[model samples]
Target: MTFQGSGPLDTSGVSAGGGGGGGRIAMGGGLGLVVTVVALLFGVNPGDIMGGSGSTGSQQVSADQSELQERIDSCTTIEQANSDDVCRLIATKNSLNDVWPTLMNGYTDPDMKIFSGSINTGCGAASSAMGPFYCPSDETAYFDPSFFQELTRMGGSDGPLAQEYVVAHEFGHHVENLTGVLAKGQRMGNDGSVRIELQADCLAGVWAQHADDGPDAMLAPLTDDQIASVIQTAKAIGDDTIQGSGSNPEGWTHGSARQRQRWFTTGYESGDPSRCDTFATDDL
Candidate 1:
């Protein structure tokens, strides 16, 4: 799918205000360490792992502006978004901002941060290896663009929709946050976490359905093969596939490949956000 043009942006730490990080704290240990390690494979917010307070440690975050960040700020056209990974992320973010408001009443845009190495957040400091996560404390989605390359490493498509699915999934967490169901995902021990994660996949799918419709649409209509690739991407991040032989349903925080694919298909085929109620579905 193609994106629209001239969505110029200037973000501060991850907002419209420009500059570098607000601050940073030294990385931490104990439960923080455990959650970080676990979230490394998926887009889980570490703050939610603690049910609140995402402390990485006790050190201030590094504040230098990166060359990579400079390039992200310069990206203003669809061509760049199509050619560059970071640009694609920005474009996807813009598209999500456009599509979600119609389905969600009083929906507002979420702040986004593009970072390398480490950065500070409303929750706490986080490193790139933790993968992409949304900091509900600050209403921001954090991404280390380099992580997208891991799609192929995880046996998923490295195509545009796959990356967009990731972006949408993180934003889906924001939508959940607004709907007051995000806190339900705090129960990592039971099926609560898995259900929320699957719901996020479905919400991302909901965005995919209407991404190319309406005048505010930022993306071109998706092709059937592109949709299949998104499904492949959804299946790639499944806990069963990620855990391989060690996979256990008892320990699953995110759903299995089948559950993820089914919910995403559910949203795409239905094109209705109301149908994305993974929590109400016993079959999930």
Candidate 2:
């Protein structure tokens, strides 16, 4: 699950922000809770446990591009990425940008914004509590690295692949946007929401399959343990698993642990994006 060499990663597409100052306040909640609310409020979503959002009008925030560039400079090798989470993220983004064009036609690379506290996005203003999400309005993915720590508190793994799974999942949303899937409208109930979320998981698996495919592959061949770690992380974040109650498919937005794990496995095993059409499957 590690990258092969110490090569410079192209991080120009990423921007760093110091965080946002004001907005309408959305109650802070755990990862599961935030995701549920965001899914209900905004059709395009992802989940996380953290801070709250504000209600004020959108205020443009600037990113510290110099700081981000410094970090990118330090990550000239895969070894650096293996050691630093931020570097790993940049490397993963590089790999994603490199591989995605081959997977689909007309693929345009999306920008990633790393922020703290809260920030305004094209979708709206969001707080760190929102977790990592892709905004179709801006075609950008947003992340607050601190959420990874919260993820561990929620019984998720801290392994590298586990983290990559998250990045890949959000990026999967960007892919969904490009494919016109995000425009399909978010429906209530697990059946519709689960399909969207699970498809993202499958897309993450698709990324994993090609992450180590070519001579210029960013990562080394994935090991069984690494894949297992990702599965464990997926299970830990399952709506049912996080709820700690008996399965309730009716209220589920992200699917049960088993479903998440199964769909990810499907994409990983098939190594085909076409196989990840969760909407077509009645069994999901």
Candidate 3:
């Protein structure tokens, strides 16, 4: 799953930030916490966790524009994305920009912010522990590349497709926002939350389906191994898998590992957005 050499990438929408010091918020109990423990447990909407407020006392960390440009410049060719992690993210973003318009009407690209440590977002201040998330209020996606390492630490594969799946999944949330499906997710209970997360997973698969379709496709066709790697990553991030021995399906917000893989496969096999309606199905 590598980008083609000819496709051009515009990383102007992305910025890089430096590390800053702050009291890291633990994942456990706190009513004042922006993202609730339930949201963190499920890995669902991050903006929902932030409670629609910007960081109050958190220190503001500015991105070094010159250094950010240097990183972008280094990824001048798609081939560079194949070798470098940051470049791969940039390349994937470009590809998503190209493919999404064809799938949905009135699609506007989301801004991407690459930060170190913690950063303030439209949702609120977020640490790398929150993983990659999309803030619908500002319509931006935030990522700490180090989260890729965290994914591997959590028993997920760190292969290229595995990484791309993460990026694509966040962008899928952007798609849900654009389609007005995200609002449905804001409703009460884990049922809505699980639907939202699983649909995003399906949407990620939809993107992967067409990622290498035509001559202009940025990536080469995915290999079987790459596909397997993505499935493994999806399983690793499942609520049950993450909760381990204390796994509780009744409290699950993101569905089980089998459900995640099945929905992703459905979108991949069908290559149709209509098939991704997790909310309509009785059996998710």
Candidate 2 runs further than 4 Å off: 21-43, 46-73, 185-190
For model 1, residues 43-141, the per-residue Cα lDDT tens digits are: 555543322224333232323245665667777676677788888888888778878998999898898888765666676656665678887888988
Model 3 C-alpha lDDT versus the unseen true structure: 0.77
Q: Between candidates 1 and 3, which one is better according to lDDT?
A: 3
Ranking by lDDT: 3, 2, 1
Give the alpha carbon lDDT tens digit for every residue of 255-275 in model 2.
788999999999999889999
Candidate 2 clashing pairs, residues 3+ apart or interchain: 6-77, 6-78, 23-54, 23-55, 23-56, 24-54, 24-55, 24-56, 31-48, 31-49
For residues 1-284, could you state the per-residue lDDT of candidate 3 as single tens digits?
46776555688788775443342554443333433332463254554444222332333344343455568677777888887888888888998888899998899999888776666676666666677888788888877777888789878898988898888888988999999888887774678879988999999999999999987789898898988998998898887787678776776778889999998888888888889999898899
Task: Report the number of clashing residue pairs per model.
Answer: 10, 10, 2
The 10-residue segment of model 2 with minimum total lDDT is 41-50
Judging by lDDT against the true structure, name the best candidate: 3
Local accuracy by lDDT, each model: 0.73, 0.74, 0.77
Clashing residue pairs in candidate 3 (N, C-alpha, C atoms within 3 angstroms): 34-49, 35-49
RMSD of each: 4.8, 4.4, 3.7
RMSD in Å for candidate 2, one decimal?
A: 4.4
